[model samples]
Target: MHELWFGAFLTPTAENAHTLMRQAALAEDVGLDIIGVQDHPYQPSFLDTWTLLSVLAARTQHIRFFPDVASVPLRPPAVLARAAASLDILSGGRVELGVGSGAFWDGVAAMGGPRRTPAQAVAALAEGIEVMRALWTPGGPVAFDGEHYRLDGAAPGPFPPHRIGVWVGAYKRRMLELTGRTADGWVPSSAYAAPEELAAMSAVVDRAAADAGRDPALIRRVYNVSGRFSRLAGPGFLDGPPSLWADQLAELVHLYGMSVFVMAPTEERDLKIFAEEVAPEVRAALGREQRQAAEPGTSPSATLDESSRPRLPKRDLAELSPAQRERGMHLVRVHDGLREELAEIRKGLEQVAAGRGEVAALRSLINRLTMRQNYWTLGSFCASYCRVVTTHHTIEDERMFPALRAAQASLAPVIDRLEEEHEVIAGLLTGLDAALVAMVEDPDGIDGVRDALDALAGALLSHLEYEEQELVEPLARLDLDV
Candidate 1:
């Protein structure tokens, strides 16, 4: 199976031009994998998706770009293929194609694009795919004649640096079959097709692939999701905490084969929370599940025995003020980010072992966790701190643990155990950095890196859970903000 990908679905609003640029940059800064901009050329208030994407490509070094779903009627298939290939070559192969048959008929009419019925639109989409692939291929002049899209002796050149996935946005049976038979990926929006609705849709796609003698696993699944992040649980998808978002997203992956989750952000904060908090939690949970499925009785990830860990008395959150409860929830959010960091570390190690890793991934992990303190993953409140380890002691022992100890003297043992775990995790991080450098020098030393990763994962995941378990309620109960 392909690795899970997390990204943001940005709408290119004319007024939010600057915000759009900053958010694109932020996605890369926060270690997100890709960015998708909705295509709505008819909307006067929105910037052209391609123009926005080109500017973003120049602004950012990493992170990918794609039109969420281009209107096939508006963008001629041959021209669209050239544009995608040109950008992919220019951006070092960081582009993908998302095409839909047609939407907003009046807008298409205004733009001088052909208006077609649903059947004709699907037919056009199929022909458009043919025209695009023909143009993308390195061959002589291509000729095609279909019901809608037609190409007359079109020359193909300026090949993409890498293979660009042709992702189709579809919901109906005909479109789904086309996706299963011909498309490289499937793109669906949660707003239109909710998570529960996708299983049946995917079944159609799979059956079509089987009937067409194509492997269904070859077709990548992408979802354009949207929702809010609240401290309290609500009755819907992505309606609660970062953990809730992770659980729901992970479920989407396991059940419906959604490898790519490009969320439409409700707030600017949603972008950061999605990348730093939601993505990693989902990756970690999915990884844990895979490991468990592979080995039933032996699971190294479950290193800590929760039954033996120190626990403190809980309090009723209903009694606390909203602000007080929010402070505790804030800690949970920060802890979620740290958990994400560990997940990145584990993934990086696995990639290196498999000979598919990038040095950037390893460097990012080592640089952030060992060399310097990134305020977001660790804690923004400890901005003055030196590094993760330095901040851990200074922020936790000097400030956090002391406050909790002073507030509830009965919880001394739990606080002490957490502090010891912090020290343990710090040592494991130091070992991880050394292992990374050693692996760089000797390829065969990857086992050492993997060993280091297993130890760190065991220690860190257990520590974070223990810290949250003992501290979350106490933080809410106490008047102090730690």
Candidate 2:
């Protein structure tokens, strides 16, 4: 698959936790695959990285979430491991643990610590990784002996439901070698090195992977294009447009065999437009080789839509009609946007009640904030929809209902039935949230979301239709608030 991982750079400082949740929900709607936050201590624009991630795990589904790079030298390795594991469990294994050697001096100063030398930082990082891995591996009493630290018979962890992939942020030779030997993936930020320079490090990583008896191919290569300038955009924008940028980036993939391209958009609107315009072409080009590799021996499935032209297997909302598409947009905004966030908060509380630690505790707070924001956003949508419904209902109540009541109340029974359906719609939201909580806590929770989605679709649509029936004619009779 040709996968382009993209995220918006957000922090608890500028947008706050609630904004992050809303943006994440929006990101999912716009077809972004991942969401990330930065870890910077002194920067007012930065938030506590782990806290944000743990909460994101509980809130989002399908989209991968992580810190761009967390400071390994600043925190205790065991604590980091436990936190990462909890996040993994909560996110259903969508957590990508991206770690780096240490903090920037300014960040270290902000945290009241002295910066380590490159050698010291690398040693600390390697030791931290060993400790983290040991803690995560299933079993009691894990041990690690390293130059910087030693652990004796430390009890093995609250293991993640799935293996938490380890990504090392590195650019220098030493870091690259170490990453190749141990990392599940490598994240080379644009701030660290140019793409061409990073490609040179890739060869060293391949060699180190061989030395470590690991599959070189298994180590995912990711480039974080955070501050990099691209020549791909409209006239007003700084970077280039998608087609031109894709052609340039494709050179990197074609020549250097890079795997993951994470475009961290400097501007909000630019990123959305970029994904909409560029993602498909990049996806198609990347998959061309893979598909060609499979084409010779495989029989392809049916490839036509109702019109008989070749159909793309997955299509985004942009492809749908305005009305049909709006419903999906509404559903995504409500479910991912708010309802699920509230559910994550509830789960965090449950975890805490059950005696879960810092990771679960902090996550709960983030989820609560995010969910409340979702509700506010949802309320806006509901208020708009309700205005129209209520205005229509008022006329029916004053005029039509009385006439019906004089004849037989049963004549307007459909209106009452429709009002009654609201309760069912409301109940489904609560039920769906519960299912999501279950999904986060257990492997079976995923099945719950699937079942709940089905129940919700029927319940919600019925409620909408019933409400419209009672109001549409009555609404036309008056200059409605809607």
Clashes of 1: 0
TM-score of 2: 0.57
Cα deviation at 195, candidate 1, in Å, is 1.2
Model 2 score (lDDT): 0.58
Instruction: Please list the residue runs of candidate 2 whose C-alpha ends up more than 4 Å from where it truly belongs after superposition.
Output: 1-4, 11-18, 42-45, 109-114, 226-238, 293-295, 298-482
lDDT of 2 at 163: 50
Query: What is the alpha-carbon lDDT of model 1 when measured against the actual structure?
Result: 0.75
Tens digit per residue, CA lDDT, model 2, 18-96:
7677767767777676766666655666667877776665565556776767777666788889888777655544677
lDDT, residue 10, candidate 2: 56
lDDT winner: 1
Q: Candidate 2, clashing residue pairs?
A: 230-240, 231-240, 232-239, 232-240, 232-241, 233-240, 233-241, 439-445
| Structure candidate 1, residue pairs in collision | none
Residue ranges of candidate 1 with Cα displaced over 4 Å: 295-482
